[model samples]
Target: MTVSHLFMQNYTGPLMIALQYNDLFDLDSISTSTDTDALPNGRAFTFIKAVQTVNERLVEQNKSDCLLFEVILISKECSEEIKMKVDESVKHYGLEIGKFFFCKKEELINTLQSNKVKLFLSTERDDVYEALHTGIPAALLYDQADDHVLNQLKVIFSGDVIGFSEDSLDGLSEFGFSETQIETIKTAKICMKEFAVLIGQMRRRFGQENSPLCTCVLTSWGSRNVCASALKTLREWGLDVDEAFCLAGAPCSPILAVVKPHILWDGGLLNMS
Candidate 1:
């Protein structure tokens, strides 16, 4: 789409987006640096691409006002390391890094309680859930083929979150939040406990072994673009692997509500659709 594409309304000023590091990084190995050479392989490149797509749509939505973004990094640990590594790619892409905070987890809620923060994106977390429940527009990003994150995103972003796939990029071209809509969201109340209970119920219902027995090993890195075929081979062994989910774009809660397979893999399988 071009800048002339028709949109519902216009958005003024630069939109601020919050990116949490813990959700993007491997918590176990804090020393592992990002492989900046190949993109999508690294979280920074994926986020940059999404931002570019959103900005392109922004141009179309508000032609008179140039679309701009201020990205802030949120982290409870390894803030300095994440900033240093991601800055290389961020500068290379010509995007500005607004602020980087590596405070305690509890402090995260207070940090994001700002009028400027239009949206928050991260993997699923209790704090993020609470933020959304309180009316802050947010989206959860997950790479594993599991129902847990997918189920939550369906409820939260129904129309707000950005995904890491090409399809999600196209979806960005179509939607932009309105101030009035955001106001409605602010007053909207979704209890955290309610969602937590739903997720637990889903887990117990679907996140279990359909057959008390199976054998399969699935990788959680990115889209499983690395060493994924091995898992597909296991699908042939009748070890009870779900080939349908092998190449699927993570787990989608909407999909889970429909198709129930005998075997689910990766870390997210424990979450119900």
Candidate 2:
């Protein structure tokens, strides 16, 4: 099935995002520190706040029922002490309860699948890769020290294959820019489209002017024909990105520096390493 078809099939349901508990909390610090004032990870709190802001906007517009946003924190192992610390952190951060779970590392994938997670986030590259391989949209979380927090949640998507798999690009070298290749790229099934659909629904319900979310498409397809085709595909899929940059063969660091997206779904194409 094409990415568009997958998106159309699941866009109406709630967007369940599963985040690694270790990514959000400095477990080591909480466990080792003698100080009683340790705080949760700033980046994690910012992301949570951004999502909450969107949910608030949706409620204000009376569209919360149309698109539900849910977040779950998954921890590989949790002791009572750690759980108590985490609970304190959640309350300290002014977050809601009932969002944390303790599961074995071996059962993480099953947990995500059973919960029908639309996105998975982790600080470990291997964990993100594992989730991607399991056909779940996942991204590596990066720590940002900057104190400035944007009320709007910014998400970036790469136009190429949206997951870790590169098999979808196998024919590109053979066909080059031929019509067959262009059509293949246009119709290729990708994981990011599911995220696109979620963002699209948010944009539609919250209104572009007042929405708490911003989305961008950063692609290497700079040629007019390829870029047009990719964007046309997005439009047909009901995803209208707020910004798009055609980098051709240029480095993406410059653009990423400016965008500073809270989450990026590049499927390893952007060399985020």
Candidate 3:
């Protein structure tokens, strides 16, 4: 049997999200210091809180299952004490949605596959790229110190091709645009579809008008036809966004500033700063 076939056999059960443990918690600090009051990374804490809220909403809607959040430590340097501290911190922060696995960097991919990880998140760009290249949806988590919106889980996606398949936007970019524009739109779609499903579930469970999950789409496509085609495709796929912006060739920073999404899935195209 083919390798792809073998891989598919392990893709079972609820949507599993594999997060690099270091991305969510400060391993270096935990290992070297004995401070018991150290907190989880600010951004990581907010992300986990948002997901836990999502799970609560799912339960309210009578859903039996919740999205699984798995923490993976891809390192060989951690001591047993460090692992114990990390576990304590996870429970203390109420972020223990799933179990933790410690493995070497080389064993990361196999570990993820065996766990049926539908999405993999890491602070390392190389790791995210590797996961995407291996057909696993992945995103790079950026560290920010500013306070995020705590009441809601906000997510933003780049519309052109970030969350969409390249073939979906094929023949729509015939406009006389520069090479840069074409390249930006042709960037990887990665995990947009998976995120859409997540957002959709949140919206359904919490009611669209009162949903705690806010979603937006930001696209660089300025032409009306292109924007319309993209929106049409989203609708056909049963994906809906609360807001959308079409910035012809403008920098996405301004929109990002206002949205302040906990997660921005842009297929590694735009700067997350």
Which candidate wins on TM-score? 2
Worst 10 residues of 1 by lDDT: 154-163
TM-scores for all candidates: the values are 0.43, 0.81, 0.77
Please report how far candidate 3 places residue 140 from its true position, in Å: 2.8
Best candidate (score: lDDT): 2
| Residue 51 Cα positional deviation in candidate 1, in Å, after optimal superposition | 2.1
Better of 1 and 2 by lDDT: 2
lDDT of 2 by residue, 1-273 (tens): 766667566666668888876667778777566546655574566777777888787777774465767888888888888877777787777764336778998999999898988888776766776777677777755554344544778787666543213454654555354543333333334555666767676677666685688877777634444455556767767778788787766787888777777787655543543
Which should have the higher TM-score, number 2 or number 3? 2
Backbone clashes in candidate 1 total: 1
Per model, how many backbone clashes are there?
1, 0, 0
- Candidate 3 collision pairs: none
Candidate 3 lDDT for residue 196: 56
> Any runs in candidate 3 off by more than 4 Å, and if so which?
1-13, 63-77, 142-148, 162-187
